[model samples]
Target: MSEASNPVVEGSLRERAARRLPSHTFSDLLVPVSSALDLAEGHAAGHAQRVTYIATSLGIALGLDAPTQLACNYAGLMHDIGVVPAGAGLGAYTRGDERMVFASLPLLSPEEAAVGASDSPEIVIERIVDHVIHGARTAREFGLPAETIKGISAHHEHWDGTGYPHGLKGEDIPILGRIICLADHIESMIDQAGPLLGRRNLPLWLNQLSGIEADPNLVSVLRDLASGDQFWLGLFSADLPGEISLGCSRLREPKGMRLLGFSESLSQLVDSRFSFTVGVSARVARYSEALGRAVSLPDLRLKQLRIAALLHDLGQVSVSERIMAKPGILSVEELEVLRNHPAYSRDVVAGIYGLEEVADWVAAHHERMDGRGYPDGRAGNEIPFEARILAVADAYVAMTSDRPHRPRADDADAQQRLRGAAGSQLDGDLVEIFLRQVVS
Candidate 1:
């Protein structure tokens, strides 16, 4: 099927490309982005959603006010936002060693995994600290409330003061953090065991961890909630995303340029996974915006294009750092794995309410005018105009930036490549405008 005619590409360009598009609150956008983080961590699809639901439910049970409850929800969704950069620093470890480090740390008891331990232990501890600090900073950049920031920063802190990031004991940890900490662990447990088995063991597990890994009082609240079957059922429900949206319905939605800031922050997280690709998304967004304007795209279309550009590689998180950072050419198997990122990006973006069209554009950004591109091979007019412009912009930025396999191209050389690939690999018209209006 042609790209435009694909059943997945709903709404006309005129409707989807309106100047403002549909308004989406922070919850609407971040909920889907949270799934992308789940993919990065090798967790189940709804890990963040389940955590959010559990945390928000606990906050309500604890009688937290609306703002605090909202903070709990937001913290749950983004608690691990720092994991990408934290894992990025583990470049010295082989893929197996990296897995061992992450897998082993979780099994450590609070006292055994203290932050300043020697040798390999210290590396994991420091990375934990880096993760929380970076996550908190990203939350602040998104304009989330201070409570939400604190919750994200301190979620690892145990009640006994043994956690890596801060070692806060008892009531010292932010209440939101305590709630998220309990919820995060519980979700992980449930994920490891299916909900049915997880439900049977949850109470015993909570009692054991009380006053050690979790706040004892929060543990009591969770026990009370877990007594009812509905809690467990809702947690593992197929529609957990819907439940999360309902739970956070009260939080105020961020509007206007704030959305831009959120997208940029997410882009940074995606880029942080590899050293060579650090700011590639931001540059792609800029180039795409310039090309959009050059082609007289409406302001709304420009906004969508910029967001798609920023998030075009959201699926890159699913690729391992070992593969992404490989200095040599990839084998056929590795190349196939890398090529799936666009489809991954599309799935994540499509989950957001107002970004359906943006998702389609992102999916098609790698497509070729002559139908040689992947994930979908729509040629010529079958490709969305925005995707075509994005193709040229992405190509130009990628050519000019260093990659794992190649040094960056000089401007003249990069422009020549663009000229050579025009019509075959990229839209010819968009490529010319990019070279003249953007590069010049």
Candidate 2:
């Protein structure tokens, strides 16, 4: 174990560690990330995947090439991504009613504006319009082609210039956008369907929407496609992610920094799940990875820590907006939902292949050394070392960030609180390394 004697052996070990690390592709991350988005609405499980299938199917029917079809699918999968950051006040966007449609008239209520500066209709609409724009930006950031970005951003644009953002009309709308907009509309209608109004009224609904919401030509195609049993069967199919993969020939497999970049983008989306937690995960990722490096963790473990930190708060998507945005202390009942977020994060990450170790770290990010933490309370060494690093990183970032409940802690105060919790709450040695080396 002598330092001089171990140099060669340690270098070899690091090389092996680097080689042994697994690279996650875009599909692996996108599937679960989209699943996280779907969890924001209790009734909307698999919503994105279903829409992808429908939209892509229409893309094929419309004679789009393979790349364009894949763009349609990508747009369908990511159409709601803007919901993460603006989740609190996006009820108007999700309703799919005429009243909620984008128009020039004042949409904000006096009461809604009183909630917070960010809750105003003007702000929410800006955010809602920005959803499509944000989706396009995210698609581009993830290395999706320009077609994908255009399709996703224009998915809300209408034929008569009644849509959002650019308000393109008729042929001015991108074909990919038109297809996804129709698919999105159909999906919403089906989601709202129930005992009173079943699938039988779907045609009537389409008929009602022909000239206003979309092009009459596109509506005719959808109407024709709706008559086929195969469309319905495909719409409700269980293997949506698989189906999308089969259609998307251009999705490159992301590795190394590219993979990490995707995780960072996803972290931003996860932060969007609640307005208060914006940028929280990205900061944790930076701090945790830095601390992991400072502690001389293996290359593979550092990568795991970075990914875990990026997605640590993913479970919060399942919690209600009211609970997430509550300015006061959480009710005992609300705390129950909030407490399950870590477990939810664990489960979401675990479902994706090659990230089992990262999932464990994400699940344990809230666990305390003294066993007073949430989801699971394993104390001390029972928690993984990387999880301990995440705990410290998460604590420091959360404390330093401004929240609705309280003002942000200044650097000096945040350090004192983090230092005070070294042994019983966080790993004492990691905290010291973080304090002395990383942040300092």
Candidate 3:
């Protein structure tokens, strides 16, 4: 049997992860996504909760057949499952999506790379707009219902019929799908305004969205829900179990974050202790944001891409200065070791459950679409969008940054080379965007 399918003995990694994370439930999914969205962008900070309320309210208004409403509620809360730091200020995943995708690769195993590579990246990316591409089937593996799958799958579709996959419209859209779509959009808008923001003028905003992208009927119910004095009072009310329980979440999430954080930190600690590597860890996080923004992406997505771009070099963090500073190309063995660093980076982050998404991209920093890249030589679609975006960032950062053997490339020259590598190694879209930023 392939190693990817093979079960390995769980030891340090699985043991600690199990100890920290909670058992899976429809509820556990809500917390992490809410937290990450808050971290990313806070426009409508309670996007999840509001989505829940709006969706269920619409469900009640339409008399959603049965279990479908339940599915809508659950799917709306946890739809953006793969995003890391799922919090406010995420900036609608503008730039750093590529970066986040980059960070996710290394987290995949050789087996995963093979699986990702098994399907052509072009084919997979084509499916990205459709429900089948991103997490539809994977969600099914987790045992979600057909309605939930349909709701989540079509969440990205628009009412004007301009959305991806099969463009269903108006009443043609599944009732659950329509409810989720409106709930997610309104909730995100609410997050931008504080709890009071929604109170001040949410009715106007709800009215504005009617028939544009959201279902008109669903929008009206949302207006009705907000028209009450109890809208914010009900959601933020002290008695609600979700918010009340989140009081101590900050301290709790770190336990998961640390699992991944330590992998990077551990290498630095080891390197510093042995005096092997050349750079510092804290220094990387603060500076990498600029490097990440060097490419064109949304501000929210850029934040993560920068961190991953900063940490993309983390594999080299613990290498000996001798090896790091070596003048010429290295022996085959040295190159092999260099490739393993991506896996090292991923292993570090994988310990943190929240970072599992990030780890997958980070672990494959060196992989290529042509199947020639290393650590695992995962080609094409085997790599994720975040990883693909990150691969470009890594190249951009490495080329521009000063290295032991070579001085940084001139800005003009570096930009040209970045554009040239698109598709062969880096994503053409990312390369084009990065160049535009440089030119701008």
Candidate 1 stretches with Cα past 4 Å from truth are 1-18, 95-121, 251-257
* Model 3: CA > 4 A from native: 1-24, 28-30, 37-46, 82-132, 237-440
lDDT of 2 by residue, 243-288 (tens): 6665563544334436667778777766765556778888899999
TM-score, predicted candidate 2 vs. hidden true structure: 0.80
Q: What is candidate 3's lDDT per residue for 1-440, written digit by digit as tens?
A: 65545456445556555545333334444443343332222122354555666666667667665466557666666554323211111212223222222122222222332334333344323323322233455446445668877776777566777554567777777666677767766665655566777678677777676786678867777777677776667666644435422422422322223322323433233233122233443344433344356644456554455445445554443233334455688888767655666775665445333556766777776788787887788888898767786776567656767665678798788888877787888778767765675333
lDDT of 2: 0.74
Better of 2 and 3 by lDDT: 2
TM-score-better candidate, 2 vs 3: 2
How much lDDT does candidate 3 score? Answer: 0.53
By lDDT: ranked, best first: 1, 2, 3
lDDT (0 to 1) per candidate: 0.81, 0.74, 0.53
Error of 2 at 171 (Å): 1.9
